[model samples]
Target: MNGKFIAIEGLEGAGKTNAIKQVGKILQEQGVHKIVFTREPGGTPLAEALRTLVKYGIDDEVITHEAELLMLYAARVQVLENVIKPAVTQGAWVVTDRYDLSSQAYQGGGRGIDSGLLNTLRDTILGNFYPDLTLYMDVAPSIGLKRVRSRTSGELDRIEVEPLAFFERIRSRYQILAEKDDRIITLDASQELSEVTSALRVQLIKWLKNKGY
Candidate 1:
């Protein structure tokens, strides 16, 4: 219960993975003894399997948008029950790559799913579980997609295969979410990677100090 759950969220090539790595290192240097690093859609074994199905377009014939949403929540349920909750109970700081917000943005905003349904699912399945702080890495959709595509050697996955318009919608949703939620902080990811990392570190330290951690 004493743990702080921090989530890094953005589009595909927003440098969240690198930021998480740097943040963890900084926290370790600061003597944060108990820290847990994990990610959504694949945090646990079950979730990892589901992640493959969801991201890789496996069983595409049977995978509807609603089904995708449900599958994501199912994986999240397992991660929350088995990994995240236990780590938090042990007073471990948790840093996650993505979480519920991804679902809302990708499924609801990009895919045109029902917001009411998403809200309902979130309330019933996730309940009061929410991140203590969320770092929303803001980047242009086209730039993010270009970065991703440049790094990929093979075919794109289902999410990555989405059009630029889809990513634009997702980016817009993220900005809206940040504006609506005080716990979410926005970082301009268009800057150099080092600058973004430094900004994130400063924000995290200030957040920790404010929370009396």
Candidate 2:
């Protein structure tokens, strides 16, 4: 049987780490042994470099939104071709922390980039490529940012330091996109960790069974 590509997406502090762990556990329980884990913009060596640039940026240099978006796609393409595609083709489930949806939410909505341009870029770059299942952990920007700030002692990354309005826009786009896509499942991430985990497990199991996993 062929493998599947699963992606988890949300704003920072949406508990993506927990969601990823839960997905792995559920997949194992469902008898999926060959799983390839990945995190967007850092799955490969080249992509890792780009991830650093995107996250921290260069010394004393202003990074434009257009450049940021391009760099993200560059990193995404590298991982998609080098890691994700090969793993799934070889019958290993590919689980990624983020995917194209991040671009749509962060770059398109948060940065207020033109939707036509974003759509054109996505279609031109990726064609029909997309995750088989996308799990979106939805949380309010204020709540999510508070959770993020509480955990990290170090300074926030470039994107992480964006205003609450930025994250709010991203969250809005995420909800809009998730609602439109059948393959994307939205989980309320404002709940306690245990509750989120329970919800994730239930949803994942149902999806897995539906897919005949």
Candidate 3:
């Protein structure tokens, strides 16, 4: 059987990292072996290098929106071929930090890139690789920005440096995607961190049970 792929997605400061960690622990306690946790844009060496360049090197004016979108897929294709597909074929459950939705939200929605182009790239490059389940941690842009500013001590990433309006558009696009996709579970991320984790845990347990885990 193919391994189940679960993806966690949200804006910065939406507690995606913490939630994934907690979910891993919970899965461990449940005696689920072959659980693999990874993140996009950096799951492999090549992807990691691309991630750093995309996040930090804003001076590369050649990295236009189109270039950015293709680069993301390039990394994704590598991850899918080298890590994700192999593990899943080996019956390992995979938890990813982000996936194609980030590309859709950031490049297509936030940057005003054409949705048609994004969809075309996804179809051509990614094909039918869809998450079994996606946990979308939802929060207001203002609150999310405040949390991010308070947590990060270093320079902001290219996406983080975007204007508030950009973030708002991104968040709105996330909401729309979650609403349209039944596989996506939207969670309120504006609540206390502990509370948010608890809710996520509950939802996860329910999903696992339903999946006959």
- Please name the candidate that would achieve the greatest TM-score relative to the true structure: 2
TM-score of each: 0.96, 0.98, 0.96
lDDT of 1 by residue, 1-213 (tens): 577788889999999999899878888977886889999898988999999889886653757899889999999998988889889888998999999999999898898998999999999999999999999999999889999999999999888988899999999999999999999999999889989988998988888788786
Clashing pairs in 1: none
- Cα lDDT tens digits, model 3, 48-160, are 88888778765756567777777888889988888998999999989999999999998878988989989999999989999999999999989999999998999888878
After superposition, the stretches of candidate 1 with alpha carbons farther than 4 Å from their true spots are 59-62
Model 2 Cα shift for residue 143 (angstroms): 0.8
TM-score of 3: 0.96
RMSD of 3: 1.2
Assess each prediction's global lDDT (C-alpha) against the native. Answer: 0.90, 0.94, 0.89
Model 2 error, position 50 (Å): 0.5
Give the lDDT of residue 82 in candidate 2.
93
- For model 3, state the Cα shift of residue 211 in Å: 1.8
**C-alpha lDDT (0 to 100) for residue 123 of candidate 1:** 96
Please give, for residues 1-213, the per-residue lDDT of candidate 2 as tens digits: 678999999999999999999899899998998999999878999999999999999998999999999999999989999999889999999999999999999999999999998898889888899999999999999999999999999999999899999999999999999999999999999999999999999999999889777
TM for candidate 1 is 0.96
